[model samples]
Target chain A: MIRKALIPVFMLMVTFPIALLLLLSFGKSWVYPNIFPDQFTLQHWNDIYQINSELLMVTLKSIGISLGVSSVVTLLSFFSSKHISYSVYKSRWLFLAYIPYVFSPVILAATLQFYFTFVDVSGTFFGVILAQLFITYPFGVLIFSNFWNPRIKAIAELSNTLGGNSWITFYKVVLPLSKGVLLLCFFQVFLISWFEYGLTALIGVGKIKTLTLSVFQYIQEANIFLAALASCLLIIPPMILLYLNKRFIFTNQQTI
Target chain B: MTNQLLDIQNLSKAFEDEHILTQTSFFLQESKTLSILGKSGSGKTTLLKIIAGLEKQDNGTILLENNDITTLSAHKRNIVYLYQDALLFPHLNVFENIAFGLKLRKINAQEVKNRVTKMLYDLELQKHIHKMPTQLSGGQRQRVSFGRALIIQPKILLLDEPFGALDVDTRKQMQRLCKETLKQYKITTLFVTHDLKEALIMGDQIGKMQSGVLKTFKNKEEFLNDPSTGIKEEIEFWKNIHANEE
Candidate 1:
């Protein structure tokens, strides 16, 4: 009975804060130490669509970067993992693949600063994307390696003997079979790049101004309402992506 | 010699210092079933893989239709190997799985459909034609796998204990289906099994592997009389059971 009661209690625990944040975003005069706002208005929501709203610009920018990072990471990982899984060094490569995570993204970005300048992508949007790629592509590799098991190897051989060359076998056999896991990997790496701050902060030198930077800017300015609004904006895309992905994962294999 | 479809000559493979196959030689005739019996780790699977071009032998020549095909890649070898597990591609339905090879050959969509439809009925899997591999029972899945392999009309079919994973009843049913299909197609088959009875039932000629050496018998009488497989003792033991029942 207690456990059953705890379910709704836990729901309230998560939702209550989100409800408060929603109210604050629209609240005109929310005062300290008050459970409810002094006044409510729609000005902040209206501010989102103004001709030159920085928040709107930052949100669009973040979406663009997130989409790019997800595409490059998922694609590169798909091809790389296919080779790695079939390669003799399949499991052994995980040690090298995982080394990126050993350093905080900030630390890694800092160390790679000189190399970034040498390639002339330093402090640029491209530089930040590249940095995020370095840190997150390994995740795709790791996830994809698990997807490419001995059973998959057998299937690949089956396809080959059925008269498929490497290209035909990969696109027809591996790519289609792993589509669900690959889509899942896409969403996962999207969220990683979307939520990332430390790497962008260091490598981008703050010129790249992602939505996370906007939230941080509001926090520094002590505008808690706008900060909450920005945080709310940041959370919505992932929540939606996850709800759709939940249906997909349930419809497909459970291994992921 | 002229009728031989696959001739494996002086095949040798080793892992580190351990010899898995040493100077192994065998000749399989066209349209014949050759059953190989071996204990686990006796290089049965390795030999089959080598024949299918999925494994490299340290030394050997694989002659197919009198051509030295030892260096041919797996896709070009025209040999299909079925594993112990059915390994039906989970992404495809029964019909699609059956038609996978034809699609790869770029056969027209109508022909692919007609052939796959006919095969589904022939395999008695008409009801599950649209069902995913995961939705089928073990026997049904293996039948789809068998259909998938046979539809390609490979020059050689390698079975590595393909029915080993099924229950006894399913195994027996699969064995019957396998024998029937192989005979119907006249597919040159090399079936590797650890079960003596399965070998005897499926084989036109039976061979046994001990350590890394393989020996084939000319007939069932020779196989039954051979001591290496302990078949003579096994038959005597069964006879005792029948006598005790009497």
Candidate 2:
């Protein structure tokens, strides 16, 4: 009982920095001694909103890139995983899929940077998307492959016998059965794309200006306030996405 | 005969040098129930999979109505295999799950609605038509699973201990429901189980499997009244292994 009580306290303790950043985002100055900011001003937010349409464009670009990366990752994973699960050599393919995940992203990026430059595709949107897709595809494959095992195959076969074709079985039966896992995959890929800095920065070569890039630039300029605000903005979409995903997961769990 | 909807001839399967089934043969008559009874690892499921075209036989022939279906894929064979788990589509409501097969056939919306509605009503699942699979009880989920399979109206219905997960009471109820429903549709069923009582209750003819060979009986009385020492030994083997577990 005490452990349960202490959980929220622990959570708040860990989240205080983020919360403080969010709070400070609405304030003009952070020099106040009080626990809360004395003067709450939307001046920073308003300035970003009014002076820089670039910020909005960058935010949208980040979201667009994330969406593109997630969709490609999900599709690639779904097919590859489905193939792996149904194929004769499932174990071998699965082991191969695990290789990318074991390597650190830094090492991966450093190695791939040379290849991207050789292909004359380095520091472009396509290059970043491709890199992130490589990173996120394995997750999609792993999750969906696990989700696509014999149990799901049984359900699918049942559907097929009932007069469903392969496409029909996939969309109507297999996809729905693994919706939760797919959602989890989408959110995971989205988060990976959203927060991904080193790979994008390395491959993007300052050509791509995502929210993370904006935050990093502000931090480099010693503009902590702007950086905090940008970070707060960056955090909101994923937070909302995660919260929605939790609601879905919990609701499904309860139904089960 | 025209009535023999499925025929298996000397089918064999092996998994990584382990022979799961060998030289198995059977014929499933239309609208009749054939139950496969065996101890665990007796290769009952492997035989069913070979018949269903889900797993390939290293050497054998499967004929659907005298047409060799051995080379046919699972999807093309029109054989439905129900798992021990209900394996319902979690995202779809019960009605949608039941409608899954019809939709694949490109059936019209009106037809789908009418057929699914009839199934829901017939299965006494009207209240659960909108409920997700997770919202259903064990019995209810099994009924939905049955509905999903039956809705497709497959040529062959294969059950891999479909009621094994349910409580005793629910299992009994589901068994009764399954018998009643399949009888109405006149669907040919091939079910595998370790439970003698389930075999007796659900099977019109029982195929007693040892290792991979099947010794079939016309009825439960024939199986029980057999004076052959081999029959007695097989029954004892199954009883000692399966009956005591529950």
Candidate 3:
């Protein structure tokens, strides 16, 4: 049947780019009219192990920034979204959360550039993390806004009246109930921080060299091998996160 | 005054310019249930929330056991409030849901297990102990919610139309179970509902709320005799139906 025949085609289409990237990361070089590289080598992989490697440090820096941004944004957004959801002026607050998204990340970064430069956090490692939050935090708030409904509010109230302190009520009831949304929000925002380029470039002032910027720089310099390597490195964390999300959060009728 | 387990004096609440509850006051004796019957927008739920410390009153004094708990936080109030929806923790199984309050108090794990098991048996949910809340029926979920609240041995229990969403048969069954359990546990409860029969059946004392003002009756006879309670119209309607059948 057409459906059955199309399955492998669809799968190959989905996987071909990643497979090509992995293969190209080990290739020596590509020449004109060659579908594949002239030779394969692990020199680029070996380069990653060299002492004081920029690639290695940049990769770690990207992971650290994404992790930091995702965690703080997710936690802050979860609580802030709950407060906003319960507030009488809910729509007004939600409109404020939407302000950052009204512009492209680059333009938002440009507007915030003055504040960052004035505070002297621009071009610093912490600066990029803070800049990423400007985009991710509001997104996290928007994602979790739908999670806190009247029923959830009632449940929290019930927990309080059942003799649970605020901390107990959150970890015992709210966190457990919000696990799926939390994970989904964390993953999405992690990706946002991970693949972010324009905002990072503008705010980081090119001093904070993230893995995503390295990929863009390599591609611009026509360094196909290193570009593929950077792409492979970039895909690893999000793929693992996606696998974990599927295995745990979505397995047993859980929904965000 | 000493026998009065819970007392509210001059309670009032408002949202923006509209007053939801104004100058409402009542008292509940120890080990007795007070049923407040009111229609929607009658401020019955606001009164219950204020008593449970979930909402702060604009003006009031709430005395529990002659102790002024006016500004006490909700968790410290030792008051358990049940919502119309069961609102069970969906991630937890029936046993875990019942054990939630005990765990929150840092009780020993084995004792928590035993107490929750006993509560589950009492609620006739022993077979569904391992099932998640979403796997249970509405009546079963409500029973679990009750167990969760009652296992903590709260000082006062507030029910906000707890069985309002159940079917007629399930509602009757839940009412009977609730009455028996509250009696056995000697729980002083403030039960609010809109149903006339349910209000009369569930309470040792009866009150009617209208337009933010609550009037508590001394006895069933007084409540029935009062023309404002609509008891007379209810009785006449039933009597006329019976006569037509004859």
Second chain of candidate 1: TM-score?
A: 0.97
**Which candidate leads in TM-score?**
3
How does model 1 do on interface RMSD, in angstroms? 2.6
Candidate 1 lDDT, A1-256, residue by residue in tens: 9999999999999999888888888877767798787988888888889979988888988998899999999999987887898888777998889888988788888899889888889878888899899988999998898887888889999888888888999888888778798889899999999999988888888788888888898899988878988988898889888897987866766532
Clashes of each: 0, 2, 0
Off by over 4 Å in 2: A1-54, A85-102, A246-256, B73-76, B92-132, B151-153, B169-177, B215-230, B233-246
> Residue A55 lDDT in model 3?
97
**Candidate 2 docking classification:** acceptable
Better of 2 and 3 by lDDT: 3
* Fnat of every candidate, listed in order: 0.82, 0.67, 0.91
How far is each candidate from the true structure, as Cα RMSD in Å? Answer: 2.8, 4.9, 2.0
Worst 10 residues of 3 chain B by lDDT: B1-10
Query: Residue B32, candidate 1: how far off, in angstroms?
Result: 0.6
RMSD of 3: 2.0
Instruction: Write candidate 1's Cα lDDT for B1-246 as tens digits.
Output: 428899989999999899999999989999899999999999999999898888899998999999999999999988999999888777788888899988988999998888888778778899998888778999999999999989888999999999998999999988998899888888999999999999999999999998888998998999888787799899899999999999
C-alpha TM-score for every candidate: 0.90, 0.80, 0.95
Error of 1 at B172 (Å): 1.9
Give me the candidate number with maximum lDDT. 3
**A198-220: candidate 3 lDDT, tens digit per residue:** 99999999899999999999999
**Over 4 Å off, model 3:** A252-256, B244-246
The DockQ figures for the candidates are: 0.60, 0.47, 0.70
CAPRI-wise, candidate 1 is medium
